[model samples]
Target: MRFKSYWRTTVVAAIFLHFFVCLGLALALPLLDFEGAPIAAQEMEVVDLSEGDDGNADTEKPEPPEVKPPAPEPPAPEKPEPEPEELVLPVEMSPTEAAELDETVAEMQKQEEEAKKRGEDGKDVRPPAPPNQEVGTIISSGMTPDTRGTDFRGTVGVLVDVDAQGKIVGVFLSRKSGRFVVDQIVLNALKTFKFEPALDMNGNPMKTKRLINFPFDGSGPHPFDDDENKRMRAKRELFLRERQQQGNAPAN
Candidate 1:
């Protein structure tokens, strides 16, 4: 009986020890699971951070290109000024040349004075020829002689002196017509005569003298015919008779 009781006690002690070991094992298993899970999560977060860093590096902006400065411009060239022209002077004159110039000037002045004297003396120099009438032509223009009004009828002669310019210078009666009126008519006609200028041996004009004769009485192609003269003479006689009769009549 005692041996059997001791064996029962040993068995109960082994059972209680086994029960405590199992409870301890259960609590240790929970702690190990929690610690292992946290370690794995920390490794995953580290990989994701490494990938994000690579992506940010690709999206970053690039640096700007370096600018090159332009080259400096060259300075402009300067213009040159024009040079002055050279001057040339003539040689001085010799003593002989100076003397010749003085002589030439004196000769020129003397020549000028002589020319002036000749011009002054030329005014009084006369032409070498006398004046004459044109050939085959007489100066009978502007003369109308009327012998019918008077009883006196005669021939008249005149002498005329003409100048170098064909102008009448002087007139003289060489023969009288017996009547004063007839003489006056001849004188006036002679004064109006024009002539051609006569030339001397040198072919230069000069003054000249000439003589002319005129007749009245309807003779030798005279200006008045015989019939007209008779008619005028009869009229004049009648006028004279009337005047005499009037004079002889007694005053009223």
Candidate 2:
């Protein structure tokens, strides 16, 4: 009976201890949860405790090394636009035309030597009339220089030499236009002039001389025209347009 009493007492003590310990555990769990909530979460930072040159432990995260935006890359250099190509125009005169002129000049020189040797300079003769009332035309209707950049504009007097067949042999500039280029142009045009030969006072076609004025001013067109001159005029118009595109002046 004594032993049984002892065992019962021991069991009662164990039950009370278990109940109190369980209650304490339950209370502790709620306190732990409340203290350790997300709001109370802790962050740890490792700081270097090394002293700075000034002998003070540096704190403040060393100021993050003064970050400045990387300097903007230098703007790309702009490429210069290429210039337009110049226009190439036709040649001034053809080789064939040059050869023909050379031949004509030689024939004219021969005629001059023969005339001088014949002593026919001091003869009495009637001056040749224009082809106006005759059977042919004299001068063309316009003055054509065949080239650009002529520097003379005035009345150019010329002396023409005609052959017995009513053909033009040569032309000489009795009066110049003060510019060599202008004089040459006029001389070339005059070589194309045709007139009725002079009358030997007997109404015969004799080789003689004629004087005519070639005006090349803006006031009016020259009193001469021909197929060759017309062609040169059209070329001149086209040439000026090409010059404008090339940004250049005609050869002086």
Candidate 3:
């Protein structure tokens, strides 16, 4: 009995294993058939590259595009030349007027010739000199040395015109003293001066022009001497003292 039970259990496990193997083979059959089938090739459209769009062969190459040069610019218009204006001639003078003009020109020429002759002769002719004129002498002069002027020295030439009455008619400085003060001093002195009338050949008083020189020497001893200065100082001191005494006495 133990042997028969073992045999029956073994038969039952074998039968179950055989059913599972058959079911696995049945599920795998469609996948194996799909993998073994040959795939069909897809149909492609053919292109004829040797023909153009109209379906004809284009044997000739395309011509290069025509390149024309730029058009020439239009020329500018020329300007017109200006017309010349008409010239007007001067009117002809009458015969009498022309003759008068000629005569006037001749007269001018004649006068010019006479003037030239006179000028040439004048070169040789000496002007008549005043008959034996003598320069006037100074009778009285108001000129005094300038005490205020310091070490200044110069000479002045004065042109003095004397009248017939021994009076100075005009006086002008012919040479400058280089100092305005000196010049003014000299001029003022000359105005106050009296002159002896000039005499002609007939011994009659006559007008005359003369140049007089006035000189100032700063080194001279008129006011700058030591002795003179001391004397002046003493005099000024005495005057001041006298004035002071008088003022003091006036209190009475």
C-alpha TM-scores of all predictions: 0.30, 0.31, 0.33
Across residues 164-246, which tens digit of lDDT does each residue of candidate 3 receive?
87777666565677878877777765654555666554446788754455667653322122222243345445655665777
In model 1, where do residues sit more than 4 Å from their true spots? 1-148, 219-252
Per-candidate total of colliding backbone pairs:
6, 6, 0
Q: Rank the candidates by TM-score, best first.
A: 3, 2, 1
Tens digits of per-residue lDDT for model 1 on 88-173? Answer: 21145688965674464454444434533535547522222123421211232324354565566676655556667666665555
Name model 3 segments beyond 4 Å from true.
Answer: 1-130, 134-141, 145-148, 219-252
Q: After superposition, how far is residue 110 of candidate 3 from its true place, in Å?
A: 43
User: Lowest summed-lDDT stretch of 10 residues in model 1?
Assistant: 128-137
- Greater-TM-score candidate between 2 and 3: 3
Per-residue error (Å), model 2, residue 242: 56
lDDT at position 115, candidate 3: 37
Q: What is candidate 2's lDDT per residue for 1-252, written digit by digit as tens?
A: 344358788999999999999999998887665545456668988665555444354545455587789989999999998764322221345889657655654554444345334346775332223443121223433344443355455777665665566565655555577887777677666544445444342334466554455666644323565432343345444544665766675565
Scored by TM-score, the top model is: 3
